[model samples]
Target chain A: MQDVHTIGKYADFAVGDIRTFAEACGVTLSVTLLSLLIGTVIGIIFGLIRCSKNKLIRFLPLIIMEPLRNSPLVVQLFLVYYGLPVMAGILLKDYTAAIITLSLNTAAFFGVLVHNSILAIPVSQWEAGYALGHGKFSTFINVIARQALRLLIPQAITLYIGQLQCSSIVSLISLRDITRVGQLLSVRTMRPFAVWGIVFGLYYLVSFPLARLADYLAKRIDYTY
Target chain B: MAMIEVKNVTKQFGDLTVLDNFSVDFDHSGVTVLIGPSGTGKSTLLRCINGLEKIDEGDILVDGLSVNNKKNLKQIRKTCGMVFQQTVIFPHMNVLDNLTMSPIKLLRMSKAEAEDKARYYLDKVGLASKEKSRHNELSGGEQQRIAIARALMMSPEALLLDEITSALDPEMTREVLNILVNLAKEGVCMLCVTHEMSFAKEVASRILFMEGGKLVCDVSKDDFFGSVREENERINKFLSFIGE
Candidate 1:
């Protein structure tokens, strides 16, 4: 393992480290996009289900969400990467397992956000729907969900960036994400600080724009009506 | 035939007993003002008719469709439109979209047709030029008028208005009341809950008085203002209190 070094000597390995870190960043971006897309869709569907009047349907998502939310992410990664093959005789490639676990974890959190946002809407909104003769599902999709969207997006985007950061946990299962690439380069070059610093910079490069976009969207949300 | 019938309905909120064995039938062609003190279940009755609140016992029929029966609930709601005490406009929608949403979504009207209809109703409510205005940007009076126009777009057999003016200033209240008066003149069956006694006297065919979750008086407008005064001390006290 490399020792932590100062930025003074980082110049030595900067150019070659750039190539490696950039490629790792590409891998991170690909997985993050795929995970966020899947997570958001699943989150919306399951979140609405979680708020459903049907007792069992509402409870069923919570059963899945509870473990995904409370347990460790690294543990979940291992369970999907290793435990699934043993239990079901169906092995997921390391990258596939990483995507699945990251997406599910993100979905669980986003789903809860969706539920809370929907709940925050006044009951009168739902009554307006009823008085308008919209059925339960239509009322939810058109009336309740539309209003909840303004409340959900700011929080969801913030959590989405958190998911982007948390995606690094996939490296524990050997998926060659930015952190994994950083680790490999760190060992080969014997300069932990330089390697990890570039990795950190790459993550910030990816995340900073999203955070700015969230703020922009939050401002625009006030003008939604 | 009655436009709406509430037959021995009971509603309880954890033993609070908001409406106890309540019953009333609203005629097919008249304005009925439900006058009551606060917490008297008048609003509950309006909500019950619209199926916004469930009755613990008995049946509410709108256009002969039962409010509680699952098969008829949708039709019942369509028959009876409700405007809330609080201004419940969808802040995310502009006035045009607000009026058109249910017509397009529930009535399956084409967007262009719904938009045209929205314009017509907005015109009726004196907001023809405010179609593109967002809900939160409008005055409270404008919002309540838009709410009325939205209900009118559904072409409900009866309208249940729960103190639609409670949040408005007097000028704003008058604007909304003016629209209601026009609807009443058009003979739209309406059950309204309000403290606006003069408007009730001016428009109501029958004035139903409720107190402590029970109907204490159901009289013709003339009788309610005239001879019916001698019938009940509580009614007289309530009328006097509100300066009727």
Candidate 2:
């Protein structure tokens, strides 16, 4: 075993390494934010399709969602990063592939969530809208959407946190995110504990605020209908 | 002309028939109260008239617009405003928004015009002060009043109220019924299904007794209360049970 003094010397990490980790974290955050935006839009559009009464429209979502949900997300990432260029002849940048895979995978989960939330609303709410001479589209957007949002927000936040953490997987495709930076620095510095601890701390710092925001929303919107 | 006409309507929930070839017509001038026990298709009849529940057979016309025709749905729904038993106000909106939504969205009324109309109905329902109150923040009675006001915002040709006061205390029930009574006096065609016997007696021009998805008796207020017809033993028993 190495002496404590030698280990302590390695623990005296350079400030440049910290700066590199910070930059990597910024990349992780930006990718996660962009992925979330993409996932949310895809989720809403596909979720409406899944909830549709039209047989053809409804089946379209099921076709995409079922396979995406059943298969492993990492396998999906690999296919997008490695197999897509060979299969479809469309070359994608490494970051583009990572973002697309993560967004699509998260969207499948969100699609299911939104579909179930729409179903959970009572039939009477729709009836009330119709009885008042509102069209189906107006009723859905004005009435059902508001009620569904109250239930959707908390569950969406929880899924978003999970997705945020899962975004670390993008590092496997050489996306140069915080996890990848940590892996590189740990190997170079030969101090896995010190390097990984800072990485975990950064993740915790970002995630704790989001979790608290979720709690605040849950409490603030609490009202019995 | 009749405000509402149900022509041999048949409504079924799969194998379970709720309304079995029932037919009725209401004149465009007075309050018509439907009295019946629970699950007797009274609510179903109201819902069917407003196009909320589809009829398996026959047709319903609201203000001479056929409810069976998909193209006429918007016009038909516009003619009849319905207040449900449970307070079905949108929980996320304030009273003004709840009242103004249908008028602004459906009638294409401007925001200022809709708010003006909403305030009028709110005042009519004795809830002028509750225009900014959240649906869930108000008491059950207050919520029901807001619902009534919301329906009135459409300036409907007829109103269908399904035991709207059943969930309220007596004071609130009287408060809501008073608004209905005033609307009745103004000659708003109304089809109300309520257990408030005194209020029914006071406002109803015609009383229709329903049992087993059929109208057992369609009698004038004087005839229904003044004469004891031996043929209506079930209705008499029901009325007496409710202390009517």
Candidate 3:
């Protein structure tokens, strides 16, 4: 009873601590941005491949993405950060491993969404282009690819928010993102309210606008079906 | 030689034979109407002539060149324009864009030239003022008219209309049939697959009766309506069915 009371009282005194909060936020933003950029690239490639008629080209991405999507991101990070060096003879720096792991995991989900959006484009659109003599590659690029990008925004933002939250797990890699600092602050201050509130609020600051932007863009993009 | 020759064309999808040894020769001028019961391959025959569907056996020739080769398809398709059963307008695009897309993209016309051509054809179809209106904003009749003008923008030598007015109201059908009559007067070779026997009798220079996956009867408009005993017995029965 005394310990809980003392811990809660002590954090109120240090709620004004700005330096540690800023450091953690800076790290969180960096990881999220890097991870998102890498994930989007991987997602677009595999998403296109999954819809491909060629068996050999399509199967390779399917193998990688399924396990990445079905398994835990934490487990993936451990493999890239820890297991690869031990078994696969590949060594990666902690931050690089975190970026790689986050990207791979996010891409597995992103690829499925992107591919679905592309498939949702009606067959008649392709027929119309073809009847005009547009070849296969040009048809997919001009018709299918452009519309898929426009449709992908809402999904992408949701993933980015997930990515921002997921950045916390990378602290296990010792990169010191915002959530890591909040955890340390909570332990020292023993104030769950002050520490968790500040951390969760900072995350909201990063993610809330993303959700809103996605909603706005999804409404704006032109699509027939 | 006939401009378009379909000889012993057999088309099958798995075990179901859609067209069996179906053959017809569509001349280079005026209109030819194909009348048939449903599932007799009238629409399928029209599609095969333009290479939209490949025949399983035998051959189809447009202007005496084979359409079976991909390399030859570009030149063949350019000469053949098709209006589908349903009004398939590019819904996202406006009336003018619908007319201009193939002209600009396939024919490589300048944007200004394409726009001018679109206006001319849209005016012909009586939708000159609806240039900025999207496809869905137009009525069913208006949409089908725009589809006609879009096909015309390609300046095809031959046009294949697949039940182009079947989905329309009577007034709308009249509007399309009137356009097609005027187009036929200009000597566009037209092969129309339709249930509109009255319209076909009014416009077609020749009429074909299809049944059992074959061109079972072929005759001029006058002889088909005239009293002739040697004319097809199956055709007589089919004609009586329609009359009833």
Point to the candidate with the largest TM-score.
2
Clashing pairs in 1: none
Write one digit per residue (lDDT tens) for candidate 1, span A82-164: 99999999889988998899889988999999999999888888888888998888888898888799888888879988989
iRMS value of model 3?
2.7
Residue B153 of model 2: what lDDT?
85
Q: How accurate locally, in lDDT, is each candidate?
A: 0.87, 0.87, 0.81
lDDT of 3 by residue, B102-194 (tens): 778777899999999889988888888899998657888888888888888888888889998999999999898888887877787888998
Q: Return the candidate ranking by TM-score, descending.
A: 2, 1, 3
Give the per-residue lDDT of model 2 (tens digit) for A45-135: 8888898888888999888888989998889999998999999998889789988998998899999889988887888899899889888
Model 1 chain A poorest ten-residue lDDT run: A2-11
**Model 2, residue B204: C-alpha shift (Å):** 0.5
Overall local distance difference test of candidate 3? 0.81
How does candidate 2 score on lDDT?
Answer: 0.87
DockQ, per model, reads: 0.55, 0.73, 0.36
- Interface RMSD, candidates in the order listed: 3.0, 1.3, 2.7
Worst 10 residues of 2 chain A by lDDT: A216-225
